[model samples]
Target: MAAPLDLDQLQTFIAIADTGSFTRAADEVFRTQSAVSMQMRRLEERVGKQLFEKEGRTNRLTEDGERLLAYARRMMRLNREALSALDDNRLEGSIRIGTPDDYADRFLPEIMARFSRSNPRVELSVLCEPTVNLVELIRRGQLDIAIVTHDDEKSPSEVVRREPLLWVTSANHMVHEEQVLPLAVGRPTCLWRQATLDALDRVEREHRILFTSWSATVIIASVLAGLAVAVLPECALRPGMRVLTESEGFPPLPDGRIGILRGHSSQPEIVEALARHIAESLDNISLPAPEDTASFDFAAMNLAVRGRRHKPGQMAGW
Candidate 1:
């Protein structure tokens, strides 16, 4: 029989995957670089697969590595659950948290579920609003914690996740080819809205805001209906959408940086636990592989869009 995988080794492997470098993984795992390499060697040998390959200056996961990453993360999560379940110093308190719906849709389910399972008696109050509003609430001590779009130069916080922010259009739409591009975007104060407008201006593109809202659902609905193009972080992407590339005359936008902001109202222990859960949940979310325009079924999506006469428009917030 194959040797059972070591949790320690699996952890090191996960660190390497998360950090994308042996050196950084070593620091994260509190092991020497050589020790980290040795752990991986044994792990690869036990799994009977080469888990990593060199890509340029950094190491990239091989196909087998990616496959193992999913299982490894699950194992680690289960281990955490087991420990939490057995802990005697159980925490109990109501905590209020906030995040923009853009992230709330993709992130909150796992976070809330896991945290609740671990701390059954703790009450959770969740509010979904724009990051701008969420930040104000955090400052006013109206929320215990908040997840916000991290702007390092502006409102810096503990960044928990990062992904590409892409310009996107309906997979089967010709709206992207319009001389005057129509956009479905966030309200004026939204960082993503500013980024998209700035990028368009830098390229000297003529664009008009056809729809504006704080809710990601509304922006996505407009894109799906083929009414306008929009920009979204990778996690917020949905089917029937295609990423626009620089080759397609769409300028690159800034990275989407998600951060955690803690307020003074909640107990430190409660707030910290939720913050940790948020970071872990975001870490486990699998990013879709690089944009592939050919991957979406154009005809099917086009027919689906044409079959619908109207789509729900954006809401002011959340």
Candidate 2:
């Protein structure tokens, strides 16, 4: 009889593919780099095919690996659902969740739907707020968990995904060619807003804030009306919006790290379960490709912008 594929190995394989580095995958799975490599070798032998190929410094999935990814994801999701359904301890507690409106619209609905189906008895209380406020709420124990965007890479949270920031405008808008670049931005506390200002400053670009709002809808509407360009996560770009690349003379913006921040107190089992579901759901998100541009030195940008702060009205004319 042949040996069946191991679930742990499958999970490790998926982690490597998601993170794009064996070292990062090892960190994710709580295994040493050598152990991750050995598991990958074992998985390849079990499947009788090479699952990955080296592309520069990163590992690219092979044809067989690409085919297996869908199956692996489905299998893992089903396995988790079965475990939750069969467990005798029915979860019954309310979980307070917070996230920025932009992310809440794009990702939370699906995550909540899956969690609701699995743990029908648990009640979910959700709030849409800025990431800065969400982090503070989590610290104050007002929220059980929060999905937030962090500018710091060393944040002590579970990083679900990282996406490059892009300067976006409406498809028919030619605002990028204006002498004084107009920006429709979020509140001053927004990481995207800070990164956008820093990037523009690095290139000595003259810009002015034409509109400010915490609502993604309002910001997008301003862009669509040709009022201004906005900085946003690549995943948040909609169909009618076009990303501005280096060719358009826009400087590169920093990548945004989406992560889960849990409250300090011991969480209820239901909250933990929901957090796990949220992480898995975010890992499965497929963001569109960012604008094609030459790579900018993120390390230098970080160093240069360190300690620089912008107030609400400070960005009048620059």
Candidate 3:
């Protein structure tokens, strides 16, 4: 009978195969490159075959190594089965959750960590995106649940959190004669962009997108550096940003809403649990402020929108 293989050596071998570079594999396995090399040597000797072929600066696994790679992954997964079986309800299955970038960075880590502590078997995949992308992802069944900004005009979705949108600018900006306001905008899918543009058109506020991006961090950085003004959830703003347009008359924008979207017929129980978790973590969701809503020229607006849609060339503005 053959001798039993060392399980630790299998781990090192798998790491090297996965990374395809000795240095990276060593870092991944938390061993010196030399030590990893030694482990591979031992593994090759036991198998009585070369496991890798060296190319210019890189290593490629041989046929034997490739055969071993699949086995290694299977073994590691099986090794975790004992721990998974004993996991709590919250961590028993795969729970794929999605939320906006700031929400993920700020509140989600703590929530997920706590959830996993009791339910260690549960695997979590989180997606961080702007509201538009998040909503689209949900409709496409790409996510089990998503937290998105509320659509104030329609109560068509389940809500998790709500707050006012604030007009913010870079803290370092100095006022000139005309108060040049550059705007940082999310891409075409954002409702905020439409609201901002409509408000500018109605009140005759002149502004253009100084930068357009889908990343919340990039948008915030640009605003903080005095590149442009932006509208965002009040909770997102900290001390360094300045409120540029703090009027009682600023048009009411969509509420800062987190929607709980579900992928149909898939892990509904886990999805419900995740939604409950978000609502609990974020507090009660609600509509935009009643008093802040700007008086709209509803008659004129409806005509313009319908006209633009039905008869493009005839709308007054067009």
Candidate 4:
């Protein structure tokens, strides 16, 4: 029978996969670069598969490495669950977390499942609100932690994920080609709204906000119905939507940033654990480009979104 793989080595492998660098993985796992190299060498020999290859400056996972990554994550997760289940001092309490509805559908499932499995006794309470409201709630001690849209100058947070913010319209509609583009956007405080308007202004494109709502569902509905074009992170893209590009006259936009904010709560340990889980889940999910549009320039936005339009000041439900 084959011997079991080393969890320590698996942990290092995961770190390297997440960081995309042997050096950064060493720092993350609290090991020296040379030690990290040795661990990978041993792991390669044990598995008899070359796991990583150099891609310019960063290390890219080999095909076999990608296959191993799935197993490695599951093993480490199960290990944590087993330890937690048997530990006498396992955490047992309720923790409140807030995120915009835009992310709730795509992000919450993995995060909730991971946290619940490892800390079965802990109850998770989720709140769906705009990033601005969530930031305020965290500040007022109403929430233990919040997943928010990062704005360094406004709602400062520890950015956990980033993806391309793109222009989207109904797949069957040419709403983007209208002389005065009609838009469905968030309220005045929504960062995406400003960014959209600014991008149009920079290109001297005339636009009008035909549908205004903070709700991602509402904006998505409008876009799908061919009522208007909208700006959204890559994850929020739905099947019926087509991405707009510079050739179509849409200017480039900044990447959408998602962040974590810790509240002044008493459950520091629980809060921190959830934060780590959130970060891990985000790291594992890659950004997917729209498949319907051959001309969609995902490379321009740099890849990534969850499937909802989250803007500052807009409630997820509108």
Tens-digit lDDT string for candidate 2 (163-212): 66677877766787889999999888776788889989998899999999
Question: What's the ranking of the predictions by TM-score, best on top?
Answer: 4, 1, 2, 3
What value of lDDT does candidate 1 attain over all alpha carbons? 0.81
Residue-wise C-alpha lDDT for candidate 3, range 1-318, written one tens digit per residue: 999778789988877765779899889889999999899899899989899999887788888877776677556544544454465533457867777786666567656754564356668898787766666777777887776666645324576555556666655564211345577878876776767787767877666678888778877888777677777765466545655442423455544555566667367876765665555445422222434323322232232222111111111000
Q: Could you tally the backbone clashes for each prediction?
A: 0, 0, 4, 6
Model 2 RMSD in Å is 8.5
lDDT of 2 at 159: 69
Best candidate (score: TM-score)? 4
Q: Positional deviation of 125 in candidate 1, in angstroms?
A: 0.8
Best by lDDT: 4
Reference-based TM-score of each model: 0.80, 0.76, 0.56, 0.84
Model 4: per-residue Cα lDDT over 144-251, one tens digit each: 999888887877788777767889988788888899999999988889998999999999999998999878989999999999999998778777777787777888
Global lDDT scores for all candidate models: 0.81, 0.76, 0.63, 0.83
Per-residue lDDT value at 271 in model 2: 70
Q: Mind sharing the TM-score for model 3?
A: 0.56
lDDT per residue (tens digit) for residues 227-264 in model 1: 99998876776877877777789887777778888999
Report model 4's TM-score to 2 decimal places.
0.84
Q: How close is candidate 1 to the true structure, as a TM-score?
A: 0.80
RMSD of each candidate relative to the true structure: 7.5, 8.5, 20.3, 5.3
lDDT of 3 at 116: 60
RMSD of 3: 20.3
